[model samples]
Target: MDSISIDEILGITRGELLQGERDLKIKNVKIDSRKIQNGDLYIPIIGEKNNGHEYIEQAFLNGGSVSLTQEKDRPFPEKMTVILVESTLEAMKALASFNRHRYQLPVIAITGSSGKTTTKDLVASVLAQKYTTLKTEGNFNNEYGIPQTLFNLGPEHEMAVIEMGMDHLGDISKSIRSVDPDIGVITNIGLCHIERLKTQENIFLAKKEILQTLKNDGMALVNGDDGFLKKLKEEKNSYQVQTFGINDQQSIKALEYVSNSSGLQMLVEWEGKKENYSFGFPGVHNVYNCLVAIWLGHFYKMTQPEIQKGLDAFVPSGNRMNIFSIGKIKVINDAYNANPDAMKASLDVLETVGADYGRRIAVLGDMLEMGDFGPAAHYEIGEYARKKADVLIGVGDLGKEICRGYGQNRNDVYHVANADAAGACLRKIIASEDIVLIKASRGMGLEKVLDYIEGGNK
Candidate 1:
């Protein structure tokens, strides 16, 4: 990390240091006092439960050389250097914004209702083929996360892939303005955070705020297969807009498909040329991610072979469509997070791959926070799951809706209260050659069932 010294941070400070050696230079700034290291500057942010300002003494003891805080009347630590600010959080954001302007790297910002993290990972991997790349780590795509990611950037990094997530109307714009991306990518808008935004159109509007802070020469890469994105044409003199998808008119497109339980194989269309590609990640949704990365690779002038190697190197981590075999049963563990669109996509994968296999089963949990649409959305999953799978097991309160949707016609439908119960029943019911899919929101911890079915205790 190319760190700036305490003198440099003081130069950006709103107020003066209270004590300690004037010439002492701290190498890094940390918000959490608990993680403070020697020669580190800690920002005391006021928050719920406890105030960070109250921990300045502990911070100094933990080797925090300097402190940034709003309280001026607090007892001064004997030799601790203090940099007073009007507000610690605002100052931290300001420092992050200032640091962002110091880098000449291409910052790629990705956002949507779903797949932001996966898509960010894919694009970063591809870009890494040509540059020294930095990417946002797991779930660090929010207000604090965005600034933490920016603060980690140094002179050596040539490019950055930032995943921006927002639930309310001004959130995306605020984060984008902070990062000021050179490339804005939208994976696809879907039903997420509807409790605040209300409708899909509102979600689209909130997501399109990525354009608000993009550089004039930046590009907006969108999913062309998305009906909403397909209808949007670029305005003259605005930032460049490009599309990637399997259908619709797009600068990048996917052609030739062969998807099985193992993974995906397809050809990508880019710049009037087409090339075959193979990916370890399964599902058509991931194919769209590949097309986006290939488009970005072409943008950075990577040769076809290098781009192909980069695509092949990408892999899904944790529980994002990670396929594994337990004895004779095949399990598709995609229980990281769930929504209507993602559930439908997973069902599509199961239907396409289960043609000649044994019984196909879908172990689904409630899709939470849909507001008035929660029950109906869960029902939709049951409706779709019944068509693609031989058995459907629904869990949680909303799982009742899923069970009701499947109705008496589907004799294999079973509803359970939690993952442990579902797992116990599933272990006895599944037979050899059975293909099962486990999916639900993060709170449901549906992976428990996946783990149990694969021999882990729930």
Candidate 2:
């Protein structure tokens, strides 16, 4: 595949290109100086621990033609190019903005306090049925990750699905402007980043920034069931808004939903047409994700059969609600990440599935970044887990609060320090016909429990 020429890249003006061979052209962009190639342009981003500006010489030795820097020091040979900028990170955003316009692809931007990753994955999978699609990789939805994802797009791609995440104000604005999207999707705003944002209303404002930089013809796909998002009405200049929901009336709705041991089945109502769809992913909440994907599938003109096939074939990556049978044990590995809403959802699912099984266990960890509400929120979670879960295994300080809430309700409840302890305990306590649900924040790394239970394989 052909590469983006250095000339076409943003923030590469004559003054910025200080002391480089005029004939030099970069084949690709590299933020890490260590991975700089012969014709690569290096951007030195100032991060928390180390500064990329410190490695200009190493980048030169690795064969980079240009290095972007805010540092005043002239580290390289006089002949080599140093792209000077007031802020290398801001310049990176500018570069990403230029690339977004250059490609002019139909972009779908997804943001929310919850379910952004799952919804993005579902939309990308359905879009792939009819379009050459590019999607966000992992949780790379921040300032640096947005630029990198945009630059990774090649000529072969027709649609881009970018997931935007934020912990504070203005993060989404930077992310949205970087990839001026034609379709904006807000999965649902919840209490995920309450530590930084302070209130759900503030979180809604942050996520709505995706619409601020939207292309003229862009459409906003919103969750009609969410009270905060539902309050946002259409203005004259407002992009055409579409809504999706399970019970609440919406543009696209899941009229009736059903789930069993195998998977989920739902009837989606769109434009007065009701279609029954079944997905491999199990959950009532996943039905909403399925609706969004189906809407996007319709937008891309995918046939009903292709959309159905795609939704049915969809499976979550990493640890989002993955079910495994270890010997005689049924383990629900939903350890990708967790919040109050998701934890409750998983507990409900466990309650439903565990009713038929012998025993139910909830192995949970701290839901971080909850600010002052952390302990109380965890306690509420513990109280609910006590009622729904037969055994509760807690990890970290926040989890200790959850265990405390369970109080003298004494069933099988234990608070451990880390995932290693949780994993070790699982090996001993977990047995035949037991159903276990493992969940925690991304930092908790509770997937280790899955590894331990699956014999380090699943």
Candidate 3:
């Protein structure tokens, strides 16, 4: 990040410099004391279990030039600069906001229950064909992660694609307001956060917050296939609205698509032209993600060939639709995260891609944070998996519910207590050339099964 003077930071965050030269410039900002570098500003966050204020001395010892503290009377190293703020988190957000607005580049903010990361990557790839772009890394879409991403912005970046994820109301509002995106995209509304949100309507309302701080001339792109987002096309707003989906009625629609174990190819109708596009990822759900990227590329006046090059260059993040072979068997490791919607989509991929293989094996774990909807969601996913997988291994307590839904009478269905047990069962039943799908929520740690398979078991 570009260096900023202590005076500017104090002015932007309304922080008072407890000790330091106002003219000193900080070249970088960090939250973790272990990551502190020379001339870096350390902002200690107060989390539930750990207090960052306690790490101030360590940060300074590690070459931190400045630190933000909530404790006003706290003692620090003799020469270390300290700033007192009401809250370091808020101060970081303020500083991030200041850093973001320094550039007049277009910011594309994406938020949804699922596919936000993939959409961000695709959009950034397409934009990169014509401009130097920056995109969020991994699942860093939270309040803290958003600011950290914005801190990396420099004069060399021509655009940014930010992903926003939320569990409570106002989460997206805070992030969106900080970035003030030129274009907002909602991938879809689903039951991923139903525990905190309560209902689909409430989730939609929460996701819609991304548009609250959108520029007046901005454009909102949504998945027209989603019943909730489809209504957005009718809403009157300060910005223009565009719909993209496989449906015939969308503003940008995929006319026909085909997916196999190899990859996906589709015919899309955009801007009064129908063209064939192919990307090396196999999932029907990804069609929506590609459509969003395609629309954004065309909006920026990128040539069709440039857009296709971006599409061809795109790569799925690890553990999300990451296809590979373990010996003779094919493994679709979509264990990054899951909900009912995502689980069903992955099951579809398992079914379609595993068609030529020996057997379709689905080793699924719990879908956590469903609240009252947990049991039914797991059971329904089991029922959905019946036709997709020849053998089903369910992990965790809720995973047992899946086996029950898959039917106890069938010997092909097995319920295990954890990933290890699931791995053991998989080793016994999994044959050479069999296709397997491993999926669960982030909390489930279902990726262990993949590790177990690769760890000399295969």
Candidate 4:
């Protein structure tokens, strides 16, 4: 963060100075006092468990130059910059909004039920060819995280490809009101967050909030192939909507796509021109991600080679379809997060990629947040697992339903209680010429199975 005058912060956050020099320079902004550097601006947050106002003293003691406090009359040490605000969270947002206004560049905000991170990465990768891009890292797509991501924006950045994630209504709106994106991309609406959202319709409406936040002249590239999103023209009457898909009437379309164990090839048609690109990543969902990336790349006027290079360079983050070798065995560690769509896609990749190795082992787990649809979702993935995995080991209570769904593999399919059990099962089932896939929801900690297998603990 660039140095902002204490007076400037007071002006932006509508905060009044309680003590200390108004001319003091704040070179960094941090929430945690332990992470605070000398002259850093500490913004205290009021979270569910503990209030941050109590930590203000500790922050200043540990080299904080400035602090925002919701407590009107907290005892403070003299000579430190202290600012009083209605709410520290709101103050943080206000400060972030002010910081974002400093940049007059393309801010592409991406939101979806899934694939937002991958979409953001691919978009940034493509945009890097023509622009110095700033992107959202990891779970930094929320109100608190997006602002921190934006705070890194300086004079050098030409474009900001932001990922705005939401599990509820108005989450995207809050981020959009902060960053105000130039372009918005909606990957798809699905059952990922349906537990909180109640229905797919609600999830669609929640995801659609990104479009509502778009500028009047801004472009929104939606998945026309998505059954829910394809109806956006009728559901919302706002801006001129652009569509992209594999099999539909749209501005950008994938003319042809093919995938093997190695990678993927696609013929994309957009703006009356056809182009061919090869992707190092596999899975049909990534083809959609590529289409979105290509659209964003083309919109920014990047050459076909640049866009292709970016796509080729795009690697899956988190534990999503990450294919690598584990000694003599090949492994796909997709143990990050899972809904039905992501789980099925990973299973398909497991089936395809392990073909050369001959043996396929899938250590599956529960797909949480399905609500009343949990059983059916697990069943759907389980039924698919029967065809995909030569050996299927299901974990968790929901895994029982998955094992039940894959009835054909009664002998091969075994249900375990947790990652340790799954790892033990995998140790016995996996061999030198085998390909193994480990996948589950974020809560399940399925990566521990991979750790166990890789660590030679089993």
Candidate 5:
């Protein structure tokens, strides 16, 4: 990041100079003290378990030039610069907003219940064909992550793809106001974060917050297949609205598509022109993701060939549909996170991959933070998996609901208490050449089963 003077920081954050020189500039900003480098600005965050105010000394020892703190009376090392703020997080957000506006590049903010990361990666990959694009790394789509992403922007970056995630009504508004994106993309509105938002309608309202701070002439792209987003297309709006999906009514539609173990092939119809495209991932949901990237590419005046090359060059981020083999068995590690929609999509991939390789085995764990909807969601996934998977191994408490939905009469359906039990059960029942799909929410730790299988187990 470009260096910013302590004076500029104080003005942007409305913070007070607590100690040391005001003329010093910060070349980098860090929240974690352990990651502090020479000439970096350290901002202490107050989390539930641990307070970052305690790490200031360590940050200085690690070569931090400056620090921001909420503690007004705290002692500091001699010759250290400290800025005092009411809230370090709010100060950081202000600093990030300031940094974002300093660059004149077009920022594309993406938000939705699912596929946000994948869509971000795809959009960045396509834009990288002609521009030095910077995207949100991994699942850094929350409040802290969004600001950290913005702080990484430099003069070399020509475009930015920021992924915003929300669990409440105003989460997107907070991030999007800082971003002020030129284009806003919503992948789909689903039951993700239903525990906090309560209903799909509430979730849609939360997701639509991406447009709250959007530029007046900005473009809004949405999934037409989603009922909520489709309704959005009919609403009166200040900005331009366009839809992309496989359905015929979308502004940019995928007329035909085929999914297989190798990848997906699609014949898209855009602007009365028909063209074929391919991606190196196997999922129908990914087709929807590709359409967004295609629209962005065309918006920036990229040719069809360039757009296709960008799509072809795309790669899935870690733990999201990451495919690999263990001896004769194939594993699809979608263990990063799962909801009903994502689980169903992965099961569909398992069906397609297993069709060409071997038996479809689904090792699914509990989807956490589902509140009262947890049982029915898990059970519904199980019922869906019954048709897609040849053998179903359900892990965790809610996983039993999946087994129940798949039917207890079936000998192939098994319910284990956790990932450990699922690992042991898989060791006993898994056959050679079988394709396994491991999926669960972030809290489920289902990656342990993949670890167990990869740790010298056939």
Candidate 6:
């Protein structure tokens, strides 16, 4: 991998070395001033809440050796290293591209509406079995995050799994321009971010933008089961592509699957061989995530045992599909974020795991960004919840629609205003050994309900 001096960064960013050492070798790169360390290059960002430039002194206080700033007229400590740029974010993009191209490793670009993060985790887990892999974590799939992820790469990494996410057009385009992915995977196209893009077709078109940056003759894989994503099927489309799904006949598939709160067991066929495997978590939705991992394993020529070990040892990140025993109560905490498709899948898992006790409880919150689709989407999930769970609790304004749908089937529907009130209402009605599912959009912060009920993570 190529190492950069202050000279190279200035050249790439078109920045002027306003003050400080020309020979300074950047040992690390950080965007947050509070995390900047001695010998680290700090890029202060202009965010919605605070200007990073205002924290230049703080960065210096935290031992930041070099800094990138756009403020030209500001006074600074004597002889300190400062690179002046037109835009800190644009400069970060330029520097990231420079840093990325220096390493000749293959970059797998993973993108889709809902399960991108989980898919990224599975891909990393499998690939790391055979290679020193670097992957994106947390919210590190965006513009600033991608650049920071790139900067974290060192000479030890043998491969890169870069996750790209977008809300509008050109978001993934910009990230891919820097990543130059050798392989591309689209998990599935769904109704997420539709309010901004308006329609599913528009979302499909926006997702296609990831294809523009594919390496020459690069492999593209998508969910063959999705009505929208199945459009990527080659005879039916343009790019040469493979498919992965449970039901798609011409794709890699999982047959005869069984899942519970503890884990999932499935018979998956790949490359003319069939094997049964078990993973640490339960969700039919995760079968899709594993399908992507299986094909990626084949692409890298990993042994079946290697792939199975990787899948078997993997645990989901954060709150997505995480089931825990809190005292005498069971809590399914899928509260990281929510959309209609994700909500429905989580419900399916809840129904499966909670079937024994049969006291299945669902505490649902509003699915945001639906625009005009809000009412109808909520109604669809609400109607399904009525049939699936024994008792239903609805939170958020749109949740009233869920209550209405539940009221159609049963009388035990309770509607609450927000997470706090929902937490209070749930404590009053929740019983021992009753399986509880708590999920909502990030804005609802429904995880707090677990704190109210079981005091969380017992």
How many clashing residue pairs, candidate 1?
A: 0
Tens digits of per-residue lDDT, candidate 2, 239-327, equal 78889997667889998888766678888888898888888756677887888999888877887789987786666778988877888
Residue-wise C-alpha lDDT for candidate 4, range 20-108, written one tens digit per residue: 88878888678877888898899888788878888888898899978999898888778678999888888888888788888788888
For model 1, the superposed segments whose C-alpha errors exceed 4 Å read: 48-50, 234-237, 353-357
> Candidate 3 lDDT, tens digit per residue, 384-409?
99989999999999998899889878
Q: What is the lDDT of candidate 6?
A: 0.84
In model 6, what are the clashing residue pairs, if there are any?
A: none
lDDT of 1 at 347: 82
Candidate 6 lDDT over 1-458, as tens digits, reads 34579988889999998998898788888899888887788898999998888888888888887889899888876657999999999999888888888887878889888888889999999999999999998889888899999988878898899888888877888777878777888887888898999998888877777777665467788888989877676444344687888884745888668887667888988767788777777788888888899888878889888998889767778887788887778889999888888888888888888976548999999999889999889988989897778888999999998888778456688889998888888888888899999988888898888878864522
Q: Alpha-carbon error at 204 in model 3, in Å?
A: 0.4
True lDDT of residue 282, candidate 5: 82
User: For candidate 6, what's the RMSD?
Assistant: 2.1
- Candidates' lDDT values, in order? 0.82, 0.82, 0.90, 0.85, 0.90, 0.84
Off by over 4 Å in 5: none
Candidate 6 structure, TM-score to reference: 0.95
* RMSD in order of candidates: 2.2, 2.4, 1.3, 1.5, 1.3, 2.1
lDDT accuracy of residue 278 in candidate 4: 89
Model 4 segments beyond 4 Å from truth?
none
TM-score of candidate 2 to 2 decimals: 0.93
Stretches of candidate 2 off by over 4 Å are: 1-15, 77-79, 234-237, 454-458
Clashing pairs for model 5 are none
